[model samples]
Target: MVNIALGASLSTVILTVPVMEAISLYTGQPFIMAMTSVQTVMVTITLIVAAINLNDGQTNAIEGMTHFVLFATFVMLTVLGL
Candidate 1:
């Protein structure tokens, strides 16, 4: 589970900054960090919620649903660019 988490996080999100910087330099264009304030808040809240859910070394549908709902809200806000 730890390996899976690390692999998934590194593969998907960890390279964003360097890759985007390289692309910006190559193209001579500026690119934003790709994370909005809403994204930041979502991540913060997710971490808190994950801790709450995992504090007992187990998780359930309610905890999962909390995460899912938060993710959905984040996606909706992102899609609307708000």
Candidate 2:
């Protein structure tokens, strides 16, 4: 399940980028494809934590909560532009 989730997440990003870029071209709006340093760091940390959590091939509510917290952190950081 974790592997599926990870694959889906990555697929979403990979698939969305070009579509977004195409839309931007059609609309004459520049697509901001760059990530801030903080955003990049957050992504790296999130992936690392996810890998560690899934290493044992078992998970519980605590792991889910941890993921939720990390997601919340990502949202907060994005909103704050930090």
Candidate 3:
């Protein structure tokens, strides 16, 4: 599962960025290939938290709750930030 997640993320970055940039350029729009500081920090924190939680390669109620809380935080941040 972890390998699949990593592969999908890697492929998305490898494949999407260039295609997005090309389309942006073709459309005469600036391709802002960057995330906001909040987004970057949040993503970094999420990855760190996920790594810590998944280190034992097991999931439980606590893990699920933590993930749900994190996801809720993400949605709130996105909605409120905009």
Q: Pick the candidate with the highest lDDT.
A: 2
Shift of residue 40 alpha carbon in model 1, Å? 0.7
The TM-scores of all predictions, comma-separated, are: 0.64, 0.64, 0.61
lDDT-superior candidate, 1 or 2: 2
Better of 2 and 3 by TM-score: 2
Show model 1 residue runs off by greater than 4 Å: 1-6, 10-32
Worst 10 residues of 3 by lDDT: 33-42
lDDT of 2: 0.90
The 0-to-1 C-alpha lDDT of every candidate, in the order given, reads 0.88, 0.90, 0.86
- Tens digit per residue, CA lDDT, model 3, 1-82: 9899989999898999889988998999998847778877778888888999999998899887988888888888888983
Predicted candidate 2 versus true structure: per-residue lDDT over 25-71, tens digit per residue: 99999998589999898889888988989999998899889889989
Error of 2 at 73 (Å): 0.7
State the displacement of the C-alpha of residue 9, model 2, in Å, after optimal TM-score superposition: 2.9
Poorest stretch of ten by lDDT in candidate 1? 9-18
For the record, the alpha-carbon RMSD of candidate 2 to the native fold, in angstroms, is: 4.7
Q: How far is candidate 1 from the true structure (C-alpha RMSD, Å)?
A: 4.1
Regions of candidate 2 where Cα sits further than 4 Å from its true position: 1-10, 13-32
